[model samples]
Target: MAELARIQPSLWFDSDAREAMEYYVSVFPNSHIGSITEYPADSDEKHLSGMAGKILNGQFTLNGVDFVCIDGGPYFTFTEAISFVVLAKDQAELDDYWAKLSHVPEAEQCGWCKDRFGLSWQIIPENMGDLTRTPEQLQVVLGQKKIVIAELEAAGAGI
Candidate 1:
């Protein structure tokens, strides 16, 4: 809990919370896993014991945020309202991520997409995000639909 706030944000997803959490561990740098709870016998095997009720809590830290995944059901699913942004620092990084992340257009928004588990993410260059914080820079980000790494660099250098 003490270190959770240092980096990243925790997100909750119902069906694939567990699998997604583990996958994230492999995808990011300086990342490790944390505690998890299993479903009790009383519940259906299809439903991991603790997976029912008001909130199914699974605490996973990715890039160091106490990313709490909850099986809260379909009442809430991830949307553009909240998205995980991945900062790719270079063209190789961007292309690799774009290819892998945009495999499904149903879950893509320029450089943002949801994985098989319905977890939303933004795969953008790291420097792009840093530069896009200003008024003019922010426009560069919004001007395009998808994240073009070249454009990002151009935007960063104000070219």
Candidate 2:
């Protein structure tokens, strides 16, 4: 568990920084976009492309975590190694999230899904940690990869 909030999680984007921010704000509660600064045509780098103030710097609070989104272009990309999970307290919460977040059908699964922007997220039960740390039951299944949640819990429980 985190003691105090200070550092912000950074997200690099190839484009659509503003659009992504707006969609994100709508997805999670108590979240908003801060400031957005774009590049200026005056500079050699600016003439290439990008909004003059599209959102050079902005802040988004999603499910309590402060995440910063950036449009760094081909310079960087997101991978499954990093993901944001929402600990839903009930079936309703989980179902609602699964329905809304999985708007992109290509990204749906057993409680795990991804956003329209290819950002992966897991919508799970709030007390799921208790099940995973059991050290008795075993289950797992990664993303579209080798393993994922079912295996993780079983492993943690030492099944």
TM-score of each: 0.66, 0.71
Model 1: worst 10 consecutive residues (lDDT sum): 46-55
Q: Which candidate is the best by lDDT?
A: 2
Candidate 2 segments whose C-alpha is farther than 4 A from its true place? 1-5, 46-53, 103-110, 130-159
Candidate 1 structure quality by residue, lDDT tens digits, 63-88: 65567665554566766777778778
lDDT of 2 at 15: 73
Score residue 22 of candidate 2 by CA lDDT.
Answer: 88
Total backbone collisions for each predicted model: 5, 24
Candidate 1: clashing pairs of residues = 10-67, 39-48, 39-49, 39-50, 40-49
Q: What tens digits encode model 2's per-residue C-alpha lDDT throughout 19-82?
A: 8888888878888877676655434565346545555666777767788877767677766677
Candidate 1 residue runs with Cα over 4 Å from true position:
1-10, 43-55, 129-146, 151-159
- Note the Cα lDDT for every prediction shown: 0.64, 0.66
Candidate 1: what lDDT?
A: 0.64
